[model samples]
Target: MEELICMDRSQRLFEDSRKVLVGGVNSPVRAMKPYPFFVERAEGCRLYDADGRSYIDYCLGYGPLILGHANPAVVDAVAAQLEKGTLYGAPTELEIDFARKIAKHVPSAEMVRFVNTGTEATMGAIRLARGVTGKNRFVKFEGAFHGAHDYVLVKAGSGATTQGVPNSAGIPADTTKNTILAPFNDEEAIERIVEEEDDLACIILEPIIGNIGCVMPKPGYLRFLRKITKEHEVLLIFDEVITGFRLGLGGAQGYYGVKPDITTLGKILGGGLPIGCIASTRDVMEHMAPVGEVYQAGTFNGNPLSMTAGLAAIGELERPGVYEALEKTGGYMRKGLRDISEDLGIDTRVYGVASMYQMYFTGEEVTDYQSALRADKELFLRYQQELLKKGVFLPPSQYECNFISTAHREEDIERTLVEMESALRTVL
Candidate 1:
């Protein structure tokens, strides 16, 4: 049996934080049963907690740290930009440069609008779709989390699902009436909706559902959506916040060979900083702000610091073998986990693509929100806790995807697999 790690300092801090912060955490997923560990520092693929204990990190800051924590390239770029200035409330050449990089790499980015968070990106994208198409209704997959905004919050995943509150209380019925919910990978449902709802503006979804643990689309599923949406005069919006740069420079659109009318991006695009982007063809993006009827603005919309960090991060990603290495490591980790679980005779299903992955404690295939829900969540949490005891940390909930990074060495993968085997054996 693995010895339990001490978290006395984290427990004390959580107690103090609860007096001021909601649920002693900024996000619901960060809250664990016995108080989450407060990190003192992080570097490479490891996180050091307040008690000075380090663990091999698979959470990777909830899918943002593709290069891993405290990457030197990102740090140096942001440091230099700090000396120049953080924000100017005016346009900078850096914005143009970063936007050019995005346009060059992302399939849907002929034009771009920078935002402060994923919530803003998706919110703006949905509004732009509505304005351009002159339609109020839009379709979002049941477990696909676009953002926290009222428009796409119905049947949301991530923190909302983790907290058992997929539908928020504050959002009114009138607001959600336009937000139609459909199951991921269900072509019939989408076909019916598109044909029946002539006023539907767009269909927004995560090409691969990361919010509910790395559920991928069925074969030819994306192309089918692309074809149907076009025939129906409805737009298709790809929410690539978690998959953006992590999947590749072109992201899911490029990877899957399907182009979206609009794309919302965050996480890896910021290089570990706060950033979001709405990108699309010039014809589509022209509908936003100073040029078109749709209005969206943010003081921090093209912050030089975020632009600089993004440029540096993308530069590193463009290097030869970066993505290949990440893919290899991810595959290695997933195979290891699958093998370990099989050896322990545990009923589980591992799902992933590229550097993103998740293991659901269920015998059935996890393809959609309903199938994902059937997984043994309590058992998964017990495994996560056991892995923590052995210095391997995954996201605390089964609904959240774990990530790999360029910083994870072969040795780290091997050690993590060993610990995972022990944890699975103990938990099962």
Candidate 2:
């Protein structure tokens, strides 16, 4: 590979940004050791950085850009919506259309309400669960991130997990007292907790824990959760913000064949724009706002730009053989990674479903957050930095999932594999 080009402009921008921006980044994960690369533009599977170097972006804007950056359809939709109005704070046919599509695609979405962000969606879902069940407490897995809200922030994942601060500092202890922690994929531990805790509102989790590097549920674990939550009359909320649309049209619920009482969606749902949704059965959804006392509202909810972009994005996803192609691409990359690891004599494991995967620099299976933490994070980080130098970008954090988008082509995968082999050689 050519010597990594100087990111002189990117470094200058970061230094300039630090004076105005918090920690030189709008989000924590974007703050790298020296500085994160500033992107000049992006389209399809590639990103052009400030220094004019291009890279294959596997982070995919933290799993939102499912069709990849600047997909023509999504861009056109947003452009057309811009010709209309941005926000009305009033209902439109666009909202109805998008909501209808969501209800049609997701099995649990009998009714749907829009929000501006995933944080609001999960917050609304939890509030509805509490109101409907007349209960105070809800259980969430240790490393499954719902959002930044107070209720689900305890033992949150993504940036929190990556930084080793699962529990945030500003949240009041009393406010989180009703928030319970459980182990992912451990039904027995959760069953015991559910049995013991009184006034339990719900059990919420990521069906496939993406924050701690895409840890999949043990076989039958989700089914067990469904059964037990139903038995106890506690609402089951699947925080599908990361998995929704990305896993498949029906998300993890459809993929796993286990339905939840409530579902929270975001990321790709807006087709790379900012949007979120909470879906549930009519009885449960009736508790929100004008119909019932439980209040949740957003001025930007169901805005035209997001609705249009989302419709276009989903339309592309619904194209025949899109998912099959995605699977093939992911499988191709996985095979290459495994081959490289074996050739380098590196202890590594790679596993994921559909277009998402994770690589842990350990031979053992990563079933939960604790086990995932045992992997060689330093080695993984070195590998990631090396890949970046080779004009390939993975997620900066070892704990985050590497996403594959519909725009990623055979050539992109092949080039990435070659780069991975070279990067791994240096790290291992």
Candidate 3:
């Protein structure tokens, strides 16, 4: 790998930013060692840093850029909407059209309400669950990040059945008291928790665990969850913020053939813009404000600009062979990574659904968070640095999933594989 030049401009910018902004970044993950690179602009699958270093961005704006950065259709749509207005603080025909599109694609999204972000979507879903069921307690899998809200901030204790410990500061103990934690892909543990816990409102999780290196659910695991949730009369909520439009227009529920009572979507739905939605059957959705007593409102929710972008994005996804192309591209990358690891005698597992992947430096099958932790962080860090120097960019953290966008061409994957092979050789 070639020696990389110093990000002098980015370093100076970070220094100046630290004087005003906390940790010199809005998001904590952006505070990388030696200062994270500041982006000057991004188009398609590439990102240009402040220091003029261009990287093949697999981060894809943390998985929202499914159609890739500055997609022409989406850009044009938003630009057109901008001429009309940005926000009305009221309803528009575009919102109705967007919601209908969501309902048409997502199996469980019979009715939909747009929100601003994934955090807001999950938080609102939780409130709806509690209100409808008249139950305070809810169940979430360990390592499954629904959002950064008080209820979801609790971490699993020593055991799966035990109450969660508050993982973040400023979160009240009482707020998370009803938040039960269980292991991902462990059907027995979830069943046990649901059976024992009284007045449980919902079982919420990402169908495919995206937080801990894209750990997939075991076969029949989601089906089991759906059955148990139904039998127990608990609302099953699939937090498809990452999987929603990416998995397919139908999301994970459509792919796995397990319909949840409610689904929260973000990421690809916004076409790289800020947006989110909580969808459910009319029976449950009727309970939310203007129709029922359960109150939920957002000033910027369903804003026109986001609505226009989302329409264009979903429209693009509706085109034939879009997902098929993603699968082919993702498979090419996955196979190349695995073959390289095998050739180098490295214990790496490249795993994920189509268009999303993560490589864990462990030979063992990663079924849950505990198993995922076995990945070698030190080796991953070194490999990541080497890959960056070779002009390939991955997510800074090993725990995060690497995304592939429609913008990634054949040559991009081939180039990435070459850099990855070199990076692995260095680490080994």
Best by lDDT: 1
lDDT of 3 by residue, 1-428 (tens): 12233437888788889999997988665666667888999899999988799999998987899988899999999899999999897789999999899989899988998999998999999999988999989888777777767888765211111112327778778887888888888877987988898889999999988877788988999999999999999999999999998888898899899999999999899998899899999999999998987888999999998899999999999999999999899999999999998899988888987899999899899888778777786788788888888878887767778999999999999999999998888878
Off by over 4 Å in 1: 1-7
lDDT values of the candidates?
Answer: 0.92, 0.90, 0.86
Per-residue lDDT over 1-428 for candidate 1, one digit per residue giving the tens place of the 0 to 100 score: 12223538888899889999999998888998888999999999999999888999999989999999999999998998899988898899999999999999998899999998999999999999999999999999988888889988888999899889999999889988998999999999998998899789999999999999889999999999999999999999999999899889999998999999999999999999999999999999888879998999998999998899889999999999999999999999899989887888888899898999999999999889999999998999999999998999899999899999999999999999988888877877
TM-score of 1: 0.98
What are the clashing pairs of model 1? none
Q: Worst lDDT window (10 residues) for model 2?
A: 1-10
Root-mean-square deviation per candidate: 2.6, 2.6, 3.8
What residue pairs clash in candidate 3, if any at all?
Answer: none
RMSD to the native, candidate 2?
A: 2.6
Residue 334's lDDT within candidate 1 is 91
lDDT of 2: 0.90
